[model samples]
Target: MGNAIELYDWNVYAIFAPFFAAQFFNLKHPVSALLATYAVFAVAFVMRPIGGFLFGWLADRHGRRMSMLLSVGLASAGSLLIGLAPTYSSVGLTASVVLVLARLIQGLAYGGEIASSHTYIAEVAPAPRRGLWSSIICISSMSALLVATLLGATLSTVLAKQQMVGWGWRVPFVVGGVLGIVALVLRRTLSETNAYEQARTERQTGSRPSMMRGIWQNRIAGLRVIGLVVGGTVFFYTWLVAAPAYAITVKHIPAPEALWSGVIATSVMIVVLPFAGALSDRIGRRPNFVFFTLAAAALSFPLNRLIQNKAWQLTLAMTIAGVTIALVVSILPAVLAELFPTHVRAAGIGVPYSLAVALCGGTAPLLQTWLATSGRGDLFIGYSVVLLLIGTVVVLAMPETKAKPLE
Candidate 1:
């Protein structure tokens, strides 16, 4: 439920990127307006690491349940603010300022929610079936994207363009806010993990300091997380969000067709996600990680070119990419959770993962746009390849986590 609510809030903004750009920027040039909107979107990701560190600390010192509740509360507030925000015509620069602020809060909440929730779920699950249980987090998030895409499509089809830009975009935000409240209520009933309880009971004094000391001692684990996540984040945001926008705006594909292509691809990913995790459980995590990273590196260019062909071709290409993405995303939670002791697992995952996300995922759209506009679309492909190569190297160097306990 928490995963669903988080993805709902995150994808709502992404699905309505075009509408927001037109409504908020007041620019005559469509690409310029979209770029401006994406810039603001990237700025929100800048706050993720801070939120990760802050709430991760809270989760370690206080409790995971409390940290999750706080994250949902902040997401709810941000969604409501976005729903009620005025357009540029009515409020000038203040409207944009408010929009960015809302996104910052949303991003921060998102940063904390996934890391803490993943840690909680991984800790609670049995050792052997941990991969299967952790896969549900990604499944829930992908399901939320499916909902967002369907809602966006329905609204886009029913409302006239003017109405969509002016008011229809608010519907998703309002729905997201309500869903966040529901998630908060559901999360309140969850029991704290035994890992946290055991850690607390075992320690006599200065536990917080001990946890910090442990994190500092295992610095290599954090670096491994950064290396593993960088390529995955870049691939995800570029292929899913930025590519769709590029297809519509630059390639002149029909908006509905492009969106439907993504919708179909995401649906395929949701189905395959758990299977990939199960495969990792059987075969081992390192092999799957190495395969997907290499596949992403080799396929990035061809996939981009295929998507530029026709609608059906684009859908086919996206489906393949989606499968690769699913394989990577499904096992990551379990792998990261096993990297640290129970004392600081939340921070261990959140801080470094958030940093990698900020450095790679956050800038994906802007970098893609710049590359496309500069007549260097191949450069974007190169960038993805380089990241994947780095990730594959790190994955090979790091120890496999399939046999490890959560703590």
Candidate 2:
């Protein structure tokens, strides 16, 4: 439930990009409006690093349970604000401001939520099956995305184009806000991780956990997080955001078809995620990371070309890519958590992971659309390959942490 609430707003925005793009931006061309909307999306990410630091600090110093509760509430507030914001037609530039502010708040909440939640799970799950248990994070995220896409498909199928553009876009945000409430209620039952409690007691008695000291001590782990995250986040947002946006806008597929394609692809990925997590538990995280990077780097461009040729090809490409990426995403919680000890686990993971995601992940949709618009879409393919290659190197150098004891 906590994971679902953390990601609900993100998937909501990605799925409804087109409808809300028009509502938020009063541009002449649809593409220009989309770029504007994506620009706001990217801009909101600038706050992620700050959010990571603030929330990571809270988890590290106070408790993971409290941090999760606060982040979810903030996320719900942000979604509600976006749902209630005036359209450009109603309030002109003020509408854009409201939209941007709402996104910023969501970005902040998600940064903290991801780090804290992953840390919490890592500490609670059994040592031998940490990978499988931690994979629940990705499963939750994929489920949220699936729900968002299905909702979009349903709404687009039912509403006329004009009706969809008018008000249908707001429904998902309102729904996400409600889901957040459910997650909040569920999270109230969470207990503090024993690892964190032990660390906190130790700190209060004699030694205190310092964020700076933790980073300096685990600086190499921090760098590894950034390196691995670049490819992971870029590829993720590419498949998750750019592909569907391109299909609907550039390919001129009906909105319902495009949205349904997304639903099918993401649902397949969701099923694949836990299996990948279990596989990581069996074989180790490094091999899975290496396989995903090498395969994605080699196949992504060709698969992208195939997607441009046919709708079925689009579904196939997204599904394959989504599943492949799930291998990495599923194990990421365990891998990142294993890199740092409990004293700095949340902050160490949060800062580097959030920074990489903010810098690479958040801007992907805008960058891909702009590159495609400029008739250099192929560059995006090369961009993914380059990032993957870097990730391959990082994975190759990093030590395996499967079932490693949490510090």
Query: How many clashing residue pairs are found in candidate 2?
Result: 0
The runs of at least 3 residues in candidate 2 whose Cα sits more than 4 Å from the true structure, single-residue gaps closed, are: none
How far residue 327's Cα lies from its native spot in candidate 2, in Å, is 1.0
Per-candidate local distance difference test:
0.85, 0.88
Query: lDDT tens digits, residues 277-363, model 1?
Result: 888888888988899999999999898888664778778877888899788899888989989888889988899999999889988
- Candidate 1 structure lDDT: 0.85
Which 10-residue span in candidate 2 carries the lowest summed lDDT? 304-313
Off by over 4 Å in 1: 205-211
Q: Model 2: per-residue lDDT, tens digit, 152-235?
A: 989999999898888888899998888888998999999999999999888989886479888888899999999999987889
| Candidate 2 TM-score to native | 0.98
Pick by lDDT: which candidate is best?
2
